[model samples]
Target: MKKAFVAFILLIFISTSRAAKVTDWLDSYNVLWTSQSKGSYDSMPCGGGDIGLNVWVENNELLFYISRSGSLDENNCLLKSGRIRVKLTPNPFINSGFSQQLNLRKGFVDVNAGNTNIRLWVNVFSPVIHVDINSKEKLSAEVYYENWRYKDRPVRKGEGNANSYKWAIPKGLVTKADVIENSTDKVIFYHKNDAQTVFDVTVAQQGMDSVKSKMYNPIGNLTSGGMLFGDNLKFAGTSSGEYAGTDYKSWCMKSVKPSSSHHVLIALHTQQTESLNQWKQGLADIVKGIKSNDDKKRTQAWWNSFWNKSAIRINEKNKDSEAWKIGRNYQLFRYMLGCNAYGSYPTKFNGGLFTFDPARVDSTLNFTPDFRKWGGGTMTAQNQRLVYFPMLKSGDFDMMTSQFDFYLRILKNAELRSKVYWNHEGGCFTEQIENFGLPNPSEYGWKRPANFDKGLEYNAWLEYQWDTVLEFCNMILETKEYNNEKIDKYVPLIESVLTFFDEHYRMLATQRGRKVLDGDGHLVLYPGSACETYKMAYNSTSTISALTVVLEKMIEYSAADSTKSARWKQMLSTIPPITIREENGKKMIAPAKLWERINNIESPQLYPVFPWRVYGVGKKDLDVAVNTYFSDSDALKFRSHIGWKQDNIFAACLGLTKEAQRLTSLKMKDSELRFPTFWGPGYDWTPDHNWGGSGMIGLQEMLMQTNGEQILLFPAWPAEWNVHFKMHAPKNTTVEAELKDGKVTSLQVYPAERMKDVVIMIKK
Candidate 1:
C-alpha cells in the first residue's frame, strides 16, 4: 500500500513537471475583417465553389463569437452542396513524463459579429447567416442570417432556389453600419482600409446555393438554377428599402437543421465597419441563450477534460532535439487534425480547409481544393489511411468510419470495375485518385487512361496500398467489434491482393541466384516510362513490407482454419524480399532500379521503418537513408512545406529515440499559435502527412518499445523525463512510470498487465 501511494504521488510530481497548456488569447471575431482587409482569403471555402469566410475572434466578459466575413464569387463561395460547419477538438498535447488531467468544452458559433463579446450564447442550430445587427453603439445587437446572389441577376434565371433574386447588396441596403460603445449614436462607417472611416459600396455581395450546380461544364452536370439540397432548413429575409430616410436591409431566418438530410442556400455577410455595436448585439443574443459562463469557458473546460484523459509527459531537458520535437509534433499533428473535420469530402493538406480550386493555375481556371474527393494532390488511399490514424486511440470514431467506408467502397468498386475491364486478371487502383473514384484529370487528362480503365492507379499494381487496407480492416476486426462482417468481407479482398502479386511477377536469377522481380527492364524501356522509376526499381519497400505484414497476418488467421493453411503458406514464400543494395556506402532499398529518372513519388523505402516493419541495422547505412532523405537531389526536400518534405522526421525521431538520443527529435517540433499544434509541410503533410506522423506520440514503439507482442516501457526515455511518464499497451492496460536522476523510481500497471503469455520487460 505504501509503495503504491508513493508511486501515485511521484507520478503526480512527474506529470506536473512537463505539463503545459494551450494559450488561446484571441477569439475568431476580433480580427476585424472587411473588403479592404481581404478577410475572405482567411476563410474556409467550398471545393470548386466560389465563396469564402474570414474568421474574427470576438470575445469579452459578455460573449465570444467567430465573426465571419466574405462573399461568393468566381474564387470562393458557399456552394449549397457543401456542409456549413464549425467544430472543436481537444486533449492533443503529449507530455514526455506522465499523464495530466484536462477538461474540454463544447464549442458554439455566433455567425454574426455585432454581438456582446462575452455574454452571447448560440442555440443548437444556426442558419447560414442569422443573428442580425440592430444597434450602432455599445450594448446594441442584431438578429439575422443573410446571403446575396449574382450581381447582374442572370437574365435566364427564374427564382433559382432562394426567395429573393435581388439578394445582392444594392446601394439602398447599406444603412445602419458598425456599432460603438460609450458614446452618443455615432455612425461607425466601414473602413476603406482599416485605420480610416469609409467603405466600398461597390463591393459585390455573395450568392448562396444548397448544391453546387454549375451553369457551364463539359464533363460535370450542366444544371443552372441549383438544387434544393443542404441542411434543408427554413429562412427569412427583411425589406430592402429606405427607413428613417437612410437605408435598411433585413434578413429573416428559420431553423437550418435538416428535416430529412439535404442542403440549403444561405447568404453570409459583414458590414464594412468595426464599432462595438455588432459585438454588443451578438453578445446580448448569446447572453439570452447562455446557461453558463461563456463559450470560451466551456471550450476551455471541454479541452481540459479531454487532456486529462491522456497526458503526454515531455522531457524538458531534451527540448530542441528532433526526436523530442517529433514526439511533440505527433501530439500537435493530432490536435490540428482534430479541428474542423466536417464535410462530405475530406480534409486537405493543401492550402484551404475547403480551399479547392486555386482560382487560376497554369493559365487555366483549375480547382485544386476539390469537394468530391480529398483534393490538393492525389493519392487518397495513402493520405486517407493517415487521416484516420487518430481514431484508433483518441477520437469519436464516426468520422473515421465515414472516411474509411467511403474509401473501402472506392476500393471495392475499383476491383469490380477491374474485373469487368481487365477480364478478372486483377490490376487496378491508381497511384492517385479522387475521393469520388475519378482518376486525376491533370495527370491522365480528361479521358480515363486505357491502363487506368482497369482500375489500377499506376499501370503497375500498387500492391502496398492493397495490403494497407487489409491491415486496417483487420485492426478494426480484431478489436472484438460486434458488426465485424465488414472486416470479414475485406479478408477475402486481401487474399485476392496476394493472388495478384503472385501472378504478376516472373522470377529471374540475380546476385547469387537470388530470385528477383524483373520489371522486365520495362521500367528502363518505353511502356514502362509511365511507372514511377523510384517505385519501379528494386523490390519496392512498401510492397515488401506490406507483403510481409499481409503474409504474417494471413498465416495467423489461417492457423485457426486448417483448410486454408497450406495455400496461405505456399503463397507467403512467393512474396519478395526487400532489396537492400549499397549505394555509395549507404543502404538503398529500391523498387527494382530499372527506370532512368525516378519520380519523386517513390518514397516507399521508409515503409519498413514506419507503417511497415523493416530494419534497425547497426551499421552506417542509416546515414545513407538520412543523407539521401536530405540529399540535394530530393525534389520534395526544398519545397516550402517547411518540415514534411522529408518523410523521415517521424522515422528519424523513432530512430534517435531507439538510439536513446532524445536530443534529435526535439529540434523538429512545429507549433500552431504557440500551443504546440504542430506540422510543418502543410500541403505535403496532410492526414498521414501530419496526423499520421502524429501517431508516433501515442504508439511510441521507439521510446517505449514493442517487439513481438510484449511492451517495453521507457526503452529510450531521456534522463530528464525520469521525473514523470504515463503510457499503456494492449491487453491488460495502463502503466504509470517515473525516474529521478537517471535512475528508475517506480512503475505501476492498471488492471494488471498480463493478458496472455505477453511479456512485460523493464529494460535496463
Candidate 2:
C-alpha cells in the first residue's frame, strides 16, 4: 500500500509537470533536422554531435542565444561580437582545490556522493554554465553574438520547454560547459582542460564586464555539502597559480535581426601558446563561414519538409484526447530519435535513448573524468536493435541506411579484432567491440562474473554480424532485382559469417539429451539454449531456431543451384527439434537446463516471436511456445515487463486489441525519473537504459504490424481512435488505415511490390 501510494504521488507529480498546453509550451522555438544535424558520409568523428540552443522574447526584446554545439551556428557571428576580447588564462585541471567562476548568480548545487553536482539553475534570466577544469593553467575565451542559425536547427513547433537550438560540439576538446539561466544577470562560462582553450558563445550586451563568481560542488547536485571527487575533483579560484602572457586573437560580428532588424553584436576571442596564428586562421575562416550562411531560413525549410512527410491523426477525427496525447507524443518522440540516431557516438549500447544513461560501468572509470552516474558503455545486440525499431517502421529509411553504413563499418573492425582475439577464427565475436572494432583499453579480454568471455560461442556469434543484415537483406531480396555489385559485396560478407559458424560447429549426437547434434555449441549448441540459459532438459530451442532461420536465409540467397547453398540446405535437415517440458501445470520452452547460470542478459527465448521467426500464434507450436513464454515465471517480472510486456506484443496477433491497449496504459509511467518517455524501472527500477526504444515498438504494433512476410493495418488500435494512420513498410510500401465506428472502414495498401499476409483488422 505504501509503495502504491508513493507511486501514485509520483504519477500525479509527473502529470502535473507535463500538463502544459502545446502552444503555450512550445511556441518559442522551432527545430529542424538535416544533413548538418545528420552529419556527413565521412564527417568528423563519423557521427552527429548534439547542439545547444537558447532563444526567448522578453520585454519586447529578443534574447537569442546559441553555441556551436552542433553546427547549429555554421555562421560564427557570435564568435565575433562587438570589440571581441582575447586573453591567456591558466587551465584548471592542473591545480586542485581552486574554484573558478565562468558564470555566477545562478547559485550552486552539490551531489551527496563526492559533492559532485548535476546542476539545473535557470533563474528566469539565462541558462548559463561554468567550465572550470582545474585552477592551475590559463585559457582563452571567445564570444559570438547575433550569429546566423546553423543549417541544422533542433527546435520545433508544438514543443514545450524543449531545446530550440543545437550547438555542434566537435570531439577532442578539454573543457566544461556551465550555465545559470536566472538572476539579475545571466552568465555562461567555458572552463578549459589545459593551459589553452577557446570559449565560443553568442551574447547581446558587450563592453560590460560585470561578472560574478560562484563556488559550487563539482558534480553540482542540487542538495548536499560539497565532497571533492577522489580522482575527479573541481579546483578553486583564489588558488590560481599561473597565467599566460602569450598569443591572442579577436574578431567582432554584428548583425540585424531577420524579423525586426534589431541590432545584435557578436564577439570572439582565442588564446593559444603554440602556433596561435593557425588558430586565428581557423577561427577566422569558421567565423567567415558562419557570417555568410542563411541559417534561419534553411532550418525552417528543412523542418517544414520533414514534418510534412507524414501527419498523425491522433483522434483522426480529433487531434486531442488521451489516445491522441499518447499518439502525437509518440509521433514527436519518433522524430527526436530520428534526429539523434547515431547522430553522435553510434548510439549508446545500454541506454539507447532518453538521455544516454549506461546501466553500469567499471570501477577504474573513477580515475577517468566522466561521471560514474553518466552511465556505462559496451554495446550489445539486444539494445542496439531496440533503438532502431522505430527507425525501420517510421519511414526514416535514410536513418536506416546511415545506421547500416555505420554498423557495417564497425563490423569490419569487429571482424578484424575477432580474428585476433579468437585466433583469427572466422566465427566467435567478442562481447564489446570498439566503434572501430579495436577494443577499448578497459574491456578487451576483460574478465567476467560468469567465468566466460562474453564473446563465447553464443547466438550473437551469428546474430550480431549476420542477423543485423537480415532485415536489409530481406528488403533487398523482396525486390527480386539485380544490383550485382552490391549483392556480391554483401553476399560474400554474409557467406563468410556463415562459413565461420558452420566450421565451428561440433557434431555431437546428443545435445542436452536431444536425439540429434542439437544445442551444445555456441551458434549451434545442443544443450545451451536461448540467451545461453533457461535451457530445456533435452534440446536448445533458440539455437536451432536461429540456425534454422539463418541457414534457411543463407540458402535462399545463395541462388537456386549454388553448391554452398546446397550444403546449407543439408545442414538445416540435421538441426534438432526443441525439447518440451512442463512445470507446475504450465507449458514452457526449455530444452536444456531449467535455470542454468550464465552471464547473459535480456529475453532471448522471445526470439521465436520477434527478430527471428520460428514461433508465435501463426507457428505450429503456438500453444507450447506461448506457454513457454508465460510459464517462465515472474521471478524477475519487473525487468522483463513480463506479463504486461509480452501482452502488448501478443494482444495484436491474437486480435485481443483491448488487452494491448490496457497494457500500454499500464506500461507508461510518467514521472521525472521516467522521462515521459517509454523506458521503465527494470524491477530494480534504476531505469532500463537499454529498453527505451522498445516502447515505441509497442506503439507501432498497436497501430500497424508486420509479421516477417506481410504488413497489418490497425491490427491492435483501440476502437476509440476512429482515425486514419499512414505508415511505410520495408520496401517503400505506403499503408493507410482508416478506422471509423470502432472498426476499420477501409484499408489501403500502395505496396511497392506484392504484399505478404498483411492483416487488416476491421470491426467484427
Best by TM-score: 2
**What is the clash count for each candidate, in the order shown?**
133, 94
**Model 1 lDDT, residue 597, Cα:** 47
What is the lDDT, from 0 to 100, of the residue 288 in candidate 1? 44
**Model 1 per-residue lDDT tens digits across residues 1-764:** 01112223333333213223322211211212221111122232111111222222211111111212121121122122121221111101111111111111222222322321211222222212222212223231222222122122221211111111112222332211221111121111111113211111111111111111311111111111111111323333343532112233323333343121121223222322344355335434533443333433544454444443333435535755544455455444444343433333344433224222222211232221221122232334454555554444343243344444444555544444444444454323454453333343233232334444323333333312333454354444433231222356456655665664554343113322344433332111111221243533444555566667767767776788876777778766665565555656666555333434455453555555545544432223555444434332432343222322224333433344432333224323443322243233243421224334334432344344444554454443454543344444444244455555655555555444232322222223
lDDT of 2 by residue, 113-208 (tens): 111111211111111122111112222222221111111222222110111111222333221221111111111122112221111111101101
RMSD of 1: 14.6
Query: How many backbone collisions does model 2 have?
Result: 94
Question: lDDT of each structure?
Answer: 0.34, 0.35
